[model samples]
Target: MIYWSANSTNSNQQSLSGSNPKKKVHSGNANNELEWRDLEDYPLNLSQQEVMIEEGKAGSSWGKSEINSGYNSLLSRTLQVKGSKVNCFFDTEAPKILVVDDHAASRMTAAALLAMEGYEVIEADSGAAAVVLVTQKHPDLILLDVMMPGMDGFEVCHLLKQDEHTRLIPVIFITALNDRRSRIRGIEVGADDFLTKPFDRVELAARVKSLVRQKRLNEDLDHAEQVLFSIARAIESRDPNTGDHCERLVTLGQNFGEYLNLSRSQLRDLMWGGYLHDIGKVGIPDAVLLKNEQLTLEDWEMMQQHVLIGEKICQPLRSMRGVIPIIRHHHERWNGSGYPDGLKSNEIPFLAQVFQLIDIYDALTSERPYKRAFSPAEALSVMWEETQAGWRNPELMQRFTDFIHTYNLK
Candidate 1:
């Protein structure tokens, strides 16, 4: 249960729950002696009779459904009291919104509105404060003000969007500036929505709800991708000889792609391919997968089907489109002697070719069940021989050799 004191001046008072609240007030509002109690005191055992009263108004109740909705919101967010200093422990499961405005009245109004809707609202007085809060709080949505002293809304939004960690958090510019140029600027800086000042409460709620829903869906997709990666790692764990193989390939493949000036999309594909290229091996029987002796022709044929199986496994994810080629063609040879498709030189995907070199280089330099680890020079020599025999792209092979030598890569 949450307790609120309306205009009571007792600074040392305890909450109704019998806990002495911490008296650490926010620096901006030193006159307001609001104490924040321990968040663990927040009860999951909510009662129907519980009522949340307005700060200064008495004899008004928001109904049991609203109370229940607020409780549900508390499950995933830190409970913040309106018109007071907020310094509470975070409950990460809640949907949180950050309201940023230099004006105290406007900021409090927005916070109160969002908080009333059963969404956790955090406040920032300025653009700098907003950026700091975003990094620390990781709010699901941001209602940013356009005009500010330093680091305005556009700058803050641009900074947040540029970062990989914070980019997905939706931002809506709430400002008095409703001109076309400002809207275009907001779009360029990655603001998801715009709300003009004296904005309608209904419109604000609708836009916030839509963007938050979209953000959650994107998060779900990210979770699904992580699950696929976990499965790939699990499959790799089954082969003792391939320990850390995927990790090495991902690092090396990314570095080589960067050296080759590959686009961000291609680089992303190379990284995914490193983990998922051999994911089809999950479909192979353990007996064949762990075999120590040379495989019979039929066993070899079955082992070769892993690439196709892996491609099919990952085909459902639209985001994996760029990566699919790398997964399917990494084993193909320049001389058209490869399995599955048997595609000749230039027919193989370029990203796959880049990944194959990293894979082969790692294989040669790392110890295997059958062979000892070779020196970097020795590995490059072996790669050179393969390139000469038409098993690899000669131009790319020469570039790889030069890159290895220049970087002194092991």
Candidate 2:
């Protein structure tokens, strides 16, 4: 979300300006009060009052002092993530806060405080409207109103908590109701926190900050769990005759995935995809998977079911739908002759291609009951020959080689 702002000096002693044009200024102070130049006379895109009102939602009082303090804190935090002297500006990567209230004055004030505190703020007038905005915007936090017609705050919170899609989002009730029953009801309906209607700006800011921090921590933990499960079934069930096959494949797949310059989301998928690439092996009869002799034609056919088996095993992870493509297609050949589906070239998912290379490499290099491990050189020679024979994507092969060299793979 890119936001353009007129040049301005903030109360926190931070200024954002270029030699190009007119400037507007905003600042936060020791008491967290915010002061911004009244640009009513200036060609401001939005009113100064508007900015203040938005920032107020985050608990900054929007007074010159509190605004100044909040801005100072925000600047320091931004600089820590980016760097100092890079020209003070708003942090674009910051999470958004949605201020939900039927009252325009309250909504505006809260929003202003949040903005001054360096959070992007969105406003919704009713509970129904808030629900729409929540689904569309996916705000980092929701500051909900307790009283609204048609769909009240409690109902909205209940709806949000019930949906598997939005249930994890933290919601804080912001209302004038100070009754004990109201507070209990809010918690019962899954409110993470609450703020009274007439809130102390400083306290509000602190609570928002704390909630945002916890949200980040939760996201990290979720990622860790996904990664662990993705590979656990593959690693734990296999015998020593395969000799840590899943472990070796995981390392190679991860390295190759990084080489592909995959995003964190993609990396997560691949991590699990690599770890569970052989999950289908679980369904293979022990007679076939552990056979010391060469695989009979019928036995080889049964081995192919592992991909389907793996896909079925991981079906519960529909949230990780992206992973299914890679898992099912990892054995697909570039020439469209491999696996459960004969997808070729770009038709094959990228992660699957990555795993294909690593899988073959691991198979060649690892000792099996039927044969001793091949030398790295011998393995590479075989891979190269297969590439020349149109068994794998030549371009992907080159990428695999670069990945190997960059990661110093054996």
Candidate 3:
């Protein structure tokens, strides 16, 4: 039995559909005309939702292989706000939630509660159906029932968590079983929270709201990283020497970070930092960047300014604050000798240090104007020489080298 007490407080009681519809267009170019989509004015009623579901089901059968990319295009929009980082508006569209349970009553009750608060809700009656819905609907949060006929909640969660695209969507297990073993299993499978069956309405709303807010923050942060990477990649495209160097750094760096059992935050920073470390180069002149011979002192000085330029370029975006150190400090030396700032050794940001190693490895392996590409063995030997001169962290170098060789990172 689930309790469904309505919110009685008179202070600002409005259902999601009844809320203000006139939203500032979160998308479109500022240089042209701004466009606004009033969500409240065009709310989807039950009948409309049924029609969309039926249409989606019919479309699904035609392209079963494309289910991996199935996204509820109806619920999500590409939010592109234009302006200087300062003059822009930041708004998050409402969170899309998927409620998965065998009981129709539970799904209806939960959906009504979530909708009243402001979240858009979708329903899935079985684990298999929920898995399919996840890829297609792309819900921000999932409330899953523990016991079902074939695929249990634990199995469903494991499968979702295994997929990178769906993993970030938080899963809260709803179960009648309150045993220690069941709880342990949920944690093992990466369930974010647990709701013991026979639910409390207030608790449900609170948990859903809290999780959705956190997920939104993470999504925003990820979007920021992607923008930074894309800008850098565009600049890299101008130079023939760099192809997918920035992207490769992210992939290789993430692998090395994981092999070392680095925390999730550290790995995220490594990926973002690897792509962004050279963003300062976007400002460097082509003469200095593309010169075949060694750089003159003047050209070297101008090149060095890239790090500072990158730091200033990213300063306006609050979402990129975590990566600032990485952009600024990656060129710093192990022995207080390298770039923009003279600070060395422990003065280097830890995350920057992690990415610096990845950046160097990628560069060494890549073909450049003045240098031939080095094989993996040759690259390791060169890095060893740097360690001998105290130019790099000996311990981190050793671990990174071992990981690459062990995994055959090519």
Candidate 4:
């Protein structure tokens, strides 16, 4: 939530009729004059009025989906603004909000207010309806009404919070319930905040704006933690034998990447990728991945599929786009004998190359099903031997060795 110090003046205009409507008329030359009119201002016949009455609520400003989207956007944007890093939640994108309410009048009112203050808004009508819409829409904030017939706001909030899939969403109760008891009830039921009926237009805008900033920051932090935990879990699940390996790997990889003069972005991705380098193993059968004996040709093929599987799993992270290539091709040898894609030398992704060297070192120094852990010196000797066979870049190997020497990576 990047805070823009813009004054958001909530407009009192009737709900906008539809998505920006435009009309065109022939520019009158010297003889004629150009004409223009708002499509909404046009009077309607009886049949047209009926159609308008039916569709007007949905088509007008602040439909159910639009309002819910506005609220959610506000929450996400606020969290982002308060988060540790700038542009943490959004990737050069505008904040969007979602509002959920049954009444079209309320929907339009909320949308008009939010729009006047510079928010992109979407709306949903009911709790049950919002569940499906929210999953697909993923608005930043949710403005939920407390009293709906089928599933009330509390039920909706509980459902959202309970779902591991959408639990991180921040919900603010927007209702006419101004009583202290009602507000407390709203809070008790999992609402982050409550906005009463007849909310001050200016105050409402300011509060929404402020909340959006805070929500964005929180979401940014949440997203970072989520990524870190995901990577850690992926590795732990893959190599259950190496307890705490992911932690050591992250610490060591961060230092090693820093030694290699990696950019901040590169360092971040390398740290994550390094910690979860063996995540692909999760896809391998337990027998193959945890084999106590040397792998046969078939077992080796199965073992190698982990890299591709890991790549697919990590593909959703647009931030780690660079990491995916490295993760996928890390096993390739310098001589092009690697499984999956047999790219050689400079063709291998650099992050994967770095992880390749560290990963091998870690594996050698850690206990496995088949053998006891090797001494640091023995691991170093093995790496040296592998280098001679053109399995790794000598310079990178040396750099890794220097890292071990400098940091005493144990």
lDDT of each: 0.74, 0.67, 0.70, 0.65
Q: Count the backbone clashes (under 3 Å) in each candidate.
A: 2, 42, 1, 48
Model 4: CA > 4 A from native: 1-235
Name the lDDT of candidate 1: 0.74
Local accuracy of candidate 2 as per-residue lDDT tens digits, 133-219:
788778778888888777889999999999977877789997665577778999999999989866566777778887877776676
lDDT, candidate 3, equals 0.70
lDDT winner among the candidates? 1
The better candidate by TM-score, 1 or 2, is 1
TM-score for candidate 4, residues paired by index: 0.49
For each candidate, give its TM-score against the true structure. 0.73, 0.47, 0.67, 0.49
**Superposing every Cα of model 3 onto the true structure, what RMSD results?**
11.3
For residue 259, what is the lDDT in candidate 3?
90
User: Which candidate achieves the best TM-score against the true structure?
Assistant: 1
Give the per-residue lDDT of model 1 (tens digit) for 77-153.
23344432112222244478988887655665565455545466777767877777787778899999888887789
Model 2 TM-score, all chains together: 0.47
Q: After superposition, how far is residue 187 of candidate 3 from its true place, in Å?
A: 2.7
Q: How should the candidates be ordered by TM-score, best one leading?
A: 1, 3, 4, 2
